[model samples]
Target: MNFFIKLQDKISEFKLQINYMKKFPKIVFIGSTNFSLFSLKELYMKQYNIVGVITSPDNPIHKNEKYFSPVKKYALENNIPFLQPGNLLDDTFLKNLKAWNADIQIVVSFKILPKKVWDLPKMGSFNLHASLLPQYRGAAPINWVIINGENKTGLTTFFIEEKIDSGKILFQKEIEIGKEETAGELEYKLKKMSGSMIIKTLEKIMKKQIKPIDQKNINSLKYAPKISTKNCRIQWDDPSIESIYNKIRGLSPHPAAWTLLFFHKKKFVRFKIFVVKKILKKHSIPIGLIFNISSSEMRISVKEGFISIIEGQIEGKKRMNIKNLINGIKIRKNLFVR
Candidate 1:
């Protein structure tokens, strides 16, 4: 009877292994940013079968230093398969990708995929976008959402399509934008939220419980194109203090909002503003005029209000608070920001 019991236990274990294999689908992940890193780690923790990762080619950290994308770094650390293809349409890359026999592909913060690549998976490919579908749909959704002073934004997982970000929505979770939240802060919050949402989406997809909705049916569609250098320049002449404040926060801490600081006639300095607050009390000072240069505070006047520069950096200097900046730099009498 002991021998029979041992044999039965072995057979039960074999059956359990078979069940697990059948339950988990072969998944391929495509991404390159911190957002992608979080999702990939979450999937691994949840025991998903991630067969391969496709990310952007390694770029130089400096003139000679090299750096791999966050997704590539994770894959290397975990010994998972990864590919960095310059062109997704390459026949050899396609063949190798097909060899994985992935049931589905999950894309996050990656470049736009070709149809041949996106359609390789037996089930279908999906993307995790950083904003609600049909609104803020483009490369710089996160920055634009905050720049536009949106009170509410969210993440959306959608079916891949030929057009950018205009895909069938699979799942969505709304996120609130704080009054003073910077784009960098919102990015962290969204990145953390994306992992669980993607897992939930996959579970529903596998269980045949999800129904993708067409984006065309959604209202209030707004496009968020890539941010340009010109776009990052703050227009102090604009009367809307609130809009200027939003622009400052939207681009804060990275590719920050900039303005011209005139120190001498026909010569000026470029100042990148990282943090500012709207002074509700109206001021009659001319727009873009700088005053009140103290150890801890500097104020620049706008149309109807003043923008207190809480944090900023000179073009060739390190970022610093107003106190440090004032202590180190001289305050010229004719200095003004435009």
Candidate 2:
């Protein structure tokens, strides 16, 4: 009897939402590549009538003809219309979207939009950036925060305006970053947190219960640009203990902190280090000292202490026990990871 009652209640709620959808503003979501996929999935579960999905064109991958559009795939699977605008500012692009009479738009991990496209949404569009607005606002928030060794960072949802990531914050939530948190881990946490937060903000907007706060002190803003393979390498000559350790943790695991080692002064291989800890010792050892303690743990000397690299791999080689690596490679003494 209780199950039947609950089922009926859910069906009634579904009918109410579907009815409400006809009167509700049409929402067009932009940018559905990464975490945005989850945001769209959540919105669909809420019975939001997404009129269309606007995203970048599908590009070829793997081979010349193999192509994929992440947003288009998701939209097709959910039975929603999709638009892949090669140039967003094109006049025809404007004409097509305005025809939908969308209520508002949502952007997550998208390219910059021109004024013509942004103004199409009647209720005004909004975005959910990974970092706290007015700070760490750029292409790579997660990497920069971890590289700079920040103790805490947060997510911010804001009403999109003229400037990029410089809009009035609608709602913000902070997440305390663990000291050992890598860029990949931080990204995972922030994506999940921000996705739910975006849904909450949208619900509030629908109910007209939100209080917008102006972004102040724009001068304090810092940019976190995209990272390159060049900056991922470990530099032991760096004297600052914390900075070096921070870099090691920031890039470890995926895009691991690497360094170039001279094998027989002829070949160079990039190797990532892990299980790093600074130990104070009196042994007068120079930098890049490879100390073999066991088959599992090999302590490499840094400026302060031995940076224990328990696991790593050379190029085009299998990642195995450190002992196997040392034995296989015949890593000799006096060799430096320059």
Candidate 3:
């Protein structure tokens, strides 16, 4: 009786393995950043057939210091095949990619793919974009949405096309932006949600449950161009407290909203504001004036209000809260920000 029971258990385990192998299509994942790792992990944990991976080449952050992309590291640890092609249109890269014979490809947080690469898979390729279709369509959608004071944004999965982010949409899921959420915070939220969305998209595609739809009336859509140093500068003269608030948070913890500190026409230093709270009330002081510099608080006067610096970093110092930052700086009456 014991022998027969063990045999039955072995049979069940074999059947499970067989089902896992037969159900999922062959996949070749393409991604680079930590944002892309979430979806790849989900697919891996679900026992999907990952045939290959394509990611950006190792890039040097400092002289003679190069690091592997998140996707490449994962592929290496799992003993899965991978390629890091500098040019997507390279003939040798194309040959190796075609040899994988993937049933489908999934792109997440990766560079633009040429038509040849995107059209290679039998079931074609789909991309998991960070924003909903026909809106926030560009390189920095997550940052732009928050900077524009938008209360809602979401994710979209679409088929790859020649045009950037203009392909037929496969699925979309909307999320409400928090009242005081920073871009980094919102990105973290969306990153966690993206894993499940990628899985659902793949299942629906495998089951023939999705009907791709073309984007409509995109001529008037808002764009999310890459953030530049000029764009990150804090425009203190802007009348709206909300606009300045949004701009600061939208670029927080990365390409942060910055301002030049001045001590009576002498350039003092530059500071990057990360977290802030707006105080709205009637005020006669000139905008960009730094007042209330105390051991416990630091406030910058703005239009009809003051922007209380909750967290910030000096140009050459580490990030600190308002209290710590204030404690380190010398109290001066003539200090102001531009």
Instruction: For each candidate in the order shown, give its overall lDDT on alpha carbons.
Output: 0.89, 0.78, 0.91
Q: List where candidate 2 sits over 4 angstroms from the true fold.
A: 1-14, 65-69, 218-220, 252-255, 273-283, 318-328
For candidate 3, write residues 19-106 as lDDT tens digits.
Answer: 8764558899999999999999988887889999999999999998999999999999988899999999999999999998899999
User: For candidate 1, lDDT tens digit of each residue in 40-156?
Assistant: 999987778889999999898799889999899899999999989999999999999999999999999998899999988878999999998888888998999999999999999
Backbone-clash count (model 2)? 0
lDDT of 2: 0.78
Tens-place lDDT per residue, model 2, 83-197, is 8888887778778888877899999888888877777777889998888777888877877787888888888889888988888899989989897777778888887886689
TM-score of 2: 0.86
Per-prediction TM-score to the true structure, in the order listed:
0.92, 0.86, 0.93
Where does candidate 1 clash, by residue pair? none
- Flag clash pairs in model 2: none
